[model samples]
Target: MIVAIIDYGSGNLRSAAKAFERAVAEADVDARIRVTADADEVAAADRIVLPGVGAFADCRRGLLGLPGMSDALASAVLEKGRPFLGICVGMQLMATVGREHGDHPGLGWIEGEVALLPAAGEGLKIPHMGWNDLRIAAPAHPVLAGLASGAHAYFVHSYAFVPADPRRVLATVDYGAPVSAVIGRDNLVGTQFHPEKSQATGLRLITNFLGWRP
Candidate 1:
């Protein structure tokens, strides 16, 4: 099977590619990893991974700048039912819109809006950086299996996803307030944290995602 880690000139592509390579090796999954910008290649892949960083508006712009990337994504994931994983800003793009800097349209796959995270309390920072525990909301989800309680994932974002349907939320993290850490439905799943930087916990997620059927 071919796993495409899309390259849109935004994310830490090398790190993410290395993480997936390691996951495939450790998990013994028979899949090839390709970091690509080609939309046709993405549509032909068996699984897809979209990773991104920076402001929501900029990331969205980069993604949409590609001629057929969005259409390829829709054809592969929404219409064809291939498993998809979106990380950080890629995850934020699952929302209908993002409110950072200015309002911008997103992929709208998850029926949500990306908004600035609340202050939560006195010392909690805006860009919820560093390691944070994932409270697995959908423990029964296939990709979450074998994840221990309090699994800490690395995060670095100032905004959070607020889904129109609460049931779409798969996991959360406390950064003053409960922020959306993971969201998914059907063949799509996303994480606000940088799994490539989360060490063993992140690797475990990657392994699970590589092998996930849905």
Candidate 2:
């Protein structure tokens, strides 16, 4: 499989590449992964992985400035139905708006907004860091296949996704309240937690994504 890791200059490019590398190593298939700024590579890839780490607005601007990269991604995933997996802030960009940089518009692939994680009672950590359990939603998605409930995964973020459609949320994790953890709609998949850092379970999720038919 050929997986193109979208590079817009704001993502954890090398780390994301390594995660796929590790996952592919465990899987039965041969995978070719690349870190490219080329839009054509994105359009031609079998699957596209979008990873981000930083403010939503800045990342959005970087992607927009990449000439045809943004449109190519949208076309590949939205119109052509190629598999898409977004990680960390990459998942946040799929939402409609984010209050992080004063209400900037997101990719709007999913109807939602990104906001600060609500404080726990009064004084709580802002960026809910460290390992947390996933509350996998029912019917059991292929991404979550073989994964047990309450599976611990690494998380490090302040802003959380607030999905407008509850049905779109695949899994959630609690810090103070339940935050959306995994999201899948047709060919698009997203994770608020860092699957790259989340050990075995996380690596398994990446493996599933790479071998996933849809």
Candidate 3:
């Protein structure tokens, strides 16, 4: 099996690549993981991972700046129904629009808008850094297999994706209020946290994603 992690000039590509490598090895899956910006490679990949860090508009611009990259991704994930994963800003990019630094267009794969996290209460943070517990909304979801509700996952983000349809939310985290932790629909899945940096929980999720048939 071939898994392609798209490096669109954002995020810690090396870290994500290493985590995926470790996950596949531990799972005993014979999968080749490639980090590339090439549209052709992305199109040919059986599974696609899009990892991003930094501003939403910058990430989106970086992705679309590559000639034919967006089209290739759409054809592969949307048209062909290949399993797709988005991490951090990559997840936020899946939204229809982002309100950070003014209105910006996203991939529109998921109907939502990226907005700054509201203040939960006194002593709370803006970036929402550190470990947070996950509440699995869809326990039977393939990507969430073996991951129990209330499992702790590392997170670092200021903005959150508020999906238009509540059914799209697979899991949540309480940061003064409920924050979308995981979102999925059909072949598309995303996490607001960096699964690579999430330690054991992250590794298990990665392994499950590698083996997911959808």
Candidate 4:
């Protein structure tokens, strides 16, 4: 499988590529992963990975100006029916709108809004970092296939997705409230955590994603 990691200037392109490389190596899959800012490469790839680590608004602006990025990505995943996985801010950008940095619009591919995590009590960190367990809601999904409930993944974000359609929420984790962790509808998949930084379990998830049938 050819996996193209979308490079929209959000950084972490190298890390994502290395993570996929390791996962592919471990899974013994004939997967070629590339980090490219090229629109044609994204359009041609069998799988598209949108990885980001920055403000949702900023990321959206960067993507909009990425030549034929939006059209290419939409054609590859939405039109061509290929697999698409989004991580961190990349996932947030999939929402209809984000509350961060004003009420900015998103990709509108998913029915949701990106809002800051609710404050529970004093001493609670805004950016919920470190490993957290996933409350798997959809076990049949290829992304959550081998991942059992309580499977831990590294999370580092302040904003969380509140999917309009509850059925679209595949998994969630409790940092303050039950924040959406894994979200999917058809061939598209997204996560609020950093799978690349989450170690073995994360690697397993990526491997499963690569081998996912859609």
- Those runs of model 3 whose alpha carbons end farther than 4 Å from true positions after fitting are 120-123
Q: Which digits, one per residue and each the tens of the lDDT, describe model 4 over residues 1-214?
A: 7999988899588888999999998889998998988999999999999988888889999987899998998899899989889999888888999999789999999988999887435467988888899999999887887888889899989899899999989999987678899888989899899989888778988998898878
> What TM-score does candidate 1 get on C-alpha atoms?
0.97
User: What TM-score would each prediction reach against the true structure?
Assistant: 0.97, 0.96, 0.98, 0.96
Sort by TM-score, best first.
Answer: 3, 1, 4, 2
Better of 1 and 3 by lDDT: 3
Top-TM-score candidate index: 3
Q: What is the C-alpha lDDT of each candidate?
A: 0.91, 0.87, 0.93, 0.89
Error of 4 at 204 (Å): 1.0
lDDT of 1 by residue, 1-214 (tens): 9999989889999999999999989888999999999999999999999998999999988988888998999899999999999999999998999999989999989998999888545467777788889998998888888886699899999899999999999999987778899899999999999989999988988898988887
Score residue 158 of candidate 1 by CA lDDT.
89
Candidate 2: which pairs clash? none
What local lDDT does model 3 show for residue 15? 98
Better TM-score candidate (3, 4)? 3
Q: Which stretches of candidate 2 lie over 4 Å from their true place?
A: none
Residue-pair clashes per candidate, as listed?
0, 0, 0, 0
